[model samples]
Target: MIKAYSISLGALLLGLVLSLVFGSDLAFQRQWQLISGVEPEQFIDFAYLYSLLPRMTMALMVGASLGLVGSLMQQLTQNPLLSPLTMGTSSGAWLALVMLNLWVPLDIADLSAAAAMIGAMFAMFLVIAIVGIRNLSGLPVVLAGMAVNIVLGAVATAIILLNEQFASNLFIWGAGDLEQNDWFWPLWLAPRLLPAILIFLLAPRVLSLLKLGQQGAAARGLNVVPMFLLLSVVGVWLVAASITAVGVISFVGLISPNIARRVGARTTSNELWLSCIIGALLLVFTDLLANALSEQIGDVVHSGIAAALVGAPILIVLCQRQLRAQDQLSLSLPQSRLRWRNRYYGLAAFIIALIALLSLLGQHNAGSWSLAIPDAFNWLLRWPRWLTAVSAGAALAVAGCVLQRLSF
Candidate 1:
């Protein structure tokens, strides 16, 4: 626990230094003076003060909230791989916002947060329904979450694509930009997040009991159902708060708690606090790195994209390690009978081929459909879409295979 705290503090200091030094175009001393109200001249431009300081603050707060939520979620479901992203919370929120913008056509500033929270809660309930409260386990819950995430993602993407012009603003937000023009967002989010954090903090023993399986926890006089429900509400609310404040930033929850565990956060109490610290540090550093690259590239790189790039590999490594550990345990068990492998493979291949063929040959002009061989130049346009469909199908197939193996 001490080592984890030390490492987290070191990373926090490093991130703070980097953010102060390079987060803004101004000199370090000048930025400090502006921030501290030490210089009247430096305070003249409200843009620099509001944009830089608030953005950095928001990043830290959002990261910490996500980390807390992630820790709570992992404890609730006992699933390390499950986070807001994987569990459909982020996607559900995004989808709700998309639908609201599409159908309601109102000024969505105030409504977005409510919509996001509702969507997140709905997704949570759906997952609970799919994997019943009694069946709360890592693999089953994660599998249900994956299904919900896929459905929400597909719906959001389809809505955005169909209403491209209307969703132009949403596209940027969906990519998770942390660029803040004022302190309003940070001020808005802080009050909402504090309660969730407090709820989690007040229930450390409950969370610890969850580390014991449901049966064990029940044996110890823990009311598992109500506890899970409470944790789920708090976790989903934290995620919604972050999503509404910024956008859908994936994998912070997964990365933070796992890193905390690696560094020696053994108990739920230690993991919760250390995960928040590490998560804040991770986002601050990632945002700093994005800003640095943006200066050279002459284009802003979203921190969320950078995080996904970095976090995806980390997730792969974690999954690999988990699989290896599971394999060792499974080796001693009787081998399960493999069923319909060839039939499933053939069906998957056929679906991919059919989708690709339709994408390539099928065309609609002025609401009339036609199947024709396109010219060479036209084929180039169609081939990319066909290839994308094929690739997506292949990826989904691979994911299903992995999920099936993991479940077993």
Candidate 2:
């Protein structure tokens, strides 16, 4: 535990130092002076005090909160793969915020947190209902959560596209920008986190009991349903708080706990604390990296995109490890043909034909429709978009296949 803490703390300090030294155009001495409150100049001090400091603080708080939430969620669901993104909480919160902005004409800053929390809770309840609290195991829960996420994401996308003027800020926010103008976000988020942390500390024993499974927990006199619900609500609140603060930083909750466990955090308490440290360090470092690259990448190097780029590979590797472990205990089954395989191929062919037709012959204006072969330059310009769309569809199909196999 000490070693883990020391390593994470050291890394965090290193990240902070690097960020402070190089994140801005100012010299190291001037940056230190500004950070230390000996105001070098009005603009430099204001920029450092308001933007850089608050952004770093937001990264730490958001990362720690997400880590705590992830640990609690994994314990509650007894599933290592579950997180805010996988459970549809982020999309749900995003959808709710989008609706609020679309419907309400007033400034929404004050109401965003409550709306996000409500949305997260709704998404959680919907997933539970779809999978059933009783049937919370294996592929069904993940599949149900994925289904919910897809639907919510589609709705959110539609809302954004339909109301582009209203959703301009929201679109950037939903991509998880950690750049802050002041300390307001950290100040707002810090107190809300206390209750969730208190609940977590108070429920350690109850959480440990959950590892025994629902039946075993009930056999040991735990009120399985209420306890599960309570933990879940706490988890949802933590996720909502983070989302409200940082605007949907993905996979921190999923990555932190797993990394903590791998690094020798044995007990739940140790795991919780270590995960928090690791998560904070991870996000801070990622944010710093993003800041370093922001000039080159423009807005593409936001924290959420960085997290996904880093986390997705880690997730794939973990899934592969689990797959290997499961493969060892294989039970042979009778070989049988997939009766609908030919139909699946036919469906794919039909979809390809439709895409080609749309790309080559579809009318751009309502008044006139015509089919004509384009010039080489025009065709070359159009082909990339068509190819990208087709590739993305194929990738999604492949992802579904991998997920189905992993679930088994």
Q: What is the TM-score of each candidate against the true structure?
A: 0.81, 0.80
The list of candidate 1 runs beyond 4 A from truth reads 38-47, 105-107, 131-136, 324-408
Residue-wise C-alpha lDDT for candidate 2, range 1-408, written one tens digit per residue: 788889888998998888777766778877777767785566767888889889889888888888888877777777777778778898899888888888874857878778888998898789988877764544446557778888988998898899897687877788888988998888988888876666556567787777887788788999987887787887788888788778888888889999999889888788878878888888998887777678676745789888888888987776555443323334223358756676798898998897698786664557877677777887888889888998998899999788757754
The TM-score, computed over Cα atoms with residue i paired to residue i, of candidate 1 is: 0.81
Please provide, for model 1 over 302-331, each residue's C-alpha lDDT reduced to its tens digit, 9 standing for 90 to 100.
888878888889887876666545444543
**What is residue 100's positional error in candidate 2, in angstroms?**
0.9
- lDDT value, residue 239 of candidate 1: 87
As for candidate 1, its clashing pairs are none
Q: Which candidate should be chosen as best, given TM-score against the real structure?
A: 1
